[model samples]
Target: MLSSRHLIFMEVARLLSFTKASQTLFISQSAISKHIKSLEYFYKTGLFERHGNHISLTKTGQALYDKLLEASQLQESLHQEIQQLNETFRPPTKLAIGASTTISLYVLPSVLSAYLRQYPNLQINVLNRNSNNIQNALLAHEIDVGIVEGLTQVNTLTYTPFMTDDVLAVCSGKSPLRGRALVVADLPTIPVALRENGSGTLAVIDDELDKRGIPVASLPVLIRLGGTEALKNFVLADTCLAFLPKRAILKELAAGELVEVPIQDLTLQRTFYFIQRKGTESNQLVNTFIQFTKRHYSNRE
Candidate 1:
């Protein structure tokens, strides 16, 4: 457990706003200020430098903040170790996961079903969001684990390669474009539906397109949607083409409700990763689920 003053300082330092920290801690801004003043008096130095409404940590404050983060990690590690050594301790009863849209809607349902059967008493919660939001949730400690597309350079988190996914260009079976493969040059003429700006699907599509000198902005976009299912439904009901994960549309493709529109030189593929805070990799429940998921997918291949 952290001291009250240290806890207040940590929240203020992380947010860099006394008002925001107060709201996060469910306290008043004046209370936050009082704690910070006391910390400064104890340390015999200012922790933050204020320029108008903006505040930044002093060098000593940064050092203390870093140490506190390390201490938090250490405390968690010690708790896990104690649990391992105690024979009478019950296993963790809850798990929270955050995943991007595609993984949440398509890939995880069967895996989670099997996992729950194995651990009948464990409760699971899933948060479905775009890739960018999933990463933010992990950093904010809102989820115990996150699985998302692509890797980022956040040093406080650890990413492990989980699987590869392919994105396909597909259109409605009844559309005029069905069975007609296209060249990259033809894309400018056909209206396309895309995922929203922060989506991993959009990011992967744009990256592959850029490598071929075709910027996504150069294409004619008919609409932008927020999730994999919404894009798929739009493509099903409308004539616009879309790029979607292969795992997401296996049934639609199999039923001939959707047809793949192969582009002459374009193939969009990306890796999905398991994300966790750097210090929590040894967490038994998370690791168990990860290994089980790997085995589940492996057997399908």
Candidate 2:
């Protein structure tokens, strides 16, 4: 890892404000000033020209900043590659991944099990969040790859389609709506269970319904929950209906515990995406995992 001071300097250069960098780095302004002074002393040149509260990088400082950014990326990449090599002799190749709730809960676990059967030395750490959170994690460089169901494209991240998932309106077996295809306008009459605001599933549901002139807010939401399992459990035990990914309710649907209520003249669907930082298209680990996921899904079809 680069020294804290160097990382701090990089933030300062990127943001062009020591105060802003200090807040981002979670350090006091005095500490940021001390680090900058130390760097300036070592280089025997002023890195920033200060006037009032604002600061700008000097000519020499600009060159140093550019070179620092290049060197840091190279160093990090080399470290990652070297670690991958080192881990081959040692067991359990470490991989960090992030995914939206539906993929993490329903889709990826089987793929992971199959992958581990093929490569027993692999070890993975998974972070589960909403699609928007997963995208933010990718941009923050906190995870190597993300699987998301984001309705909108983020320019800073690259998205590749991994699979298509349909969102189904589901209810418990005893509900009057069971097996009865519903008109779009009937959605507002039923008591509904919903995923929370940041949910990718919720976003798609709202967007599709909005296009049909029935806003999600117009629905009679009986409860709001964070995870699919919780919402599913509620639907299983109550008459309230939920819109969930079809993949998520396969077991329940098969067991006849839940019913897929088809909507009249409308379909709800979204793509599950493999996401990475925009410039990481060629990273070995990311490529390996994405290819594995795609091939795994294709084999099922």
Candidate 3:
């Protein structure tokens, strides 16, 4: 078993902030410092380097933290195996997951429900933000795992493909573009509604459009909305067109409330990824949740 001092050191290293680690571990900042000091004394090396207000892990600290993480994983696995052998009641565990707007709203609700049913003692918290914010939260250790639209190319993060999603051009059925085949040239002529900046949907759409030699900035956007449902409602109430994930509009598309306006040779496909900090692959709870989520979607197919 890892010592309490080691656990405290890991938390502080992960967050790189004594105050944050203290709040997380429910201990006073002074107490956190004392434990870290004790660990450093035992190892006969400085574990953290301080620059006035900021703190960062030293080389020895990083190495120790990595080893402790491996040990923690082994401990958790052993505990799980023992529990399985005895069929005993397990203590409640919390898993915090951060996801982009689309996945949070359209994708994860059913999966989370099923997961809770299978593991009733587990508590799950879902943080719904745009892709950029989710990536930031993961780096800051604010969440255990993250699901986002595209790969955030930070070397410290690991991205696992969650699923592929298609963003479709759709407008209200009353719009004149209903049944009209649009070409690349016609995109700039139409009034478009778009997701706000820093949005994963917007970023993907912009990248695809740029590849086609027609930048999204060249299009005549009528309004920028924050949420998917907000933009969908705007499209329904107005005569403008918008790009939305197919999963978000299935009911409306089936009911004829919206019509898909297929542009000639324009397909917007983006892959959603499950992201976590490097070396967290050994986390059993996160691995189990990811597999369960993938299975939930695969079973439907």
Task: Estimate, for each residue in 36-68, the C-alpha lDDT of model 3 and write its tens digit.
Answer: 889889999999999999998899998998888
lDDT of 1 by residue, 7-74 (tens): 78988988889998988689999988999999999999999999998999999999989898777666
Q: Tens digits of per-residue lDDT for model 2 on 1-301?
A: 5677887887887778877888867899899989989999999999999889778899988988878866765664675588687854432355669999988987789889998887676778798998888888777656779999865788888888888888999999999888788899888899999999878899989998999999999999999999888899999999878998888899999999999988888788988889887877867766888898889979977
Record all residue pairs in model 2 with backbone atoms less than 3 Å apart, i.e. clashing. Answer: none
Candidates 1 and 2, the one with greater TM-score? 1
Candidate 1 regions with alpha-carbon error over 4 angstroms: 1-79
Question: All candidates: CA RMSD in angstroms?
Answer: 4.9, 6.6, 4.8
**TM-score of each model, paired residue for residue:** 0.75, 0.72, 0.74
User: Any runs in candidate 3 off by more than 4 Å, and if so which?
Assistant: 1-89
lDDT score of residue 167 within candidate 1: 96
Best by lDDT: 3
Q: Pull out the clashing pairs in model 1.
A: none
Q: How many clashes (backbone atoms < 3 Å, residues ≥3 apart in a chain or on different chains) does model 3 have?
A: 0
Model 3 lDDT on a 0 to 1 scale: 0.89
lDDT of 2: 0.84
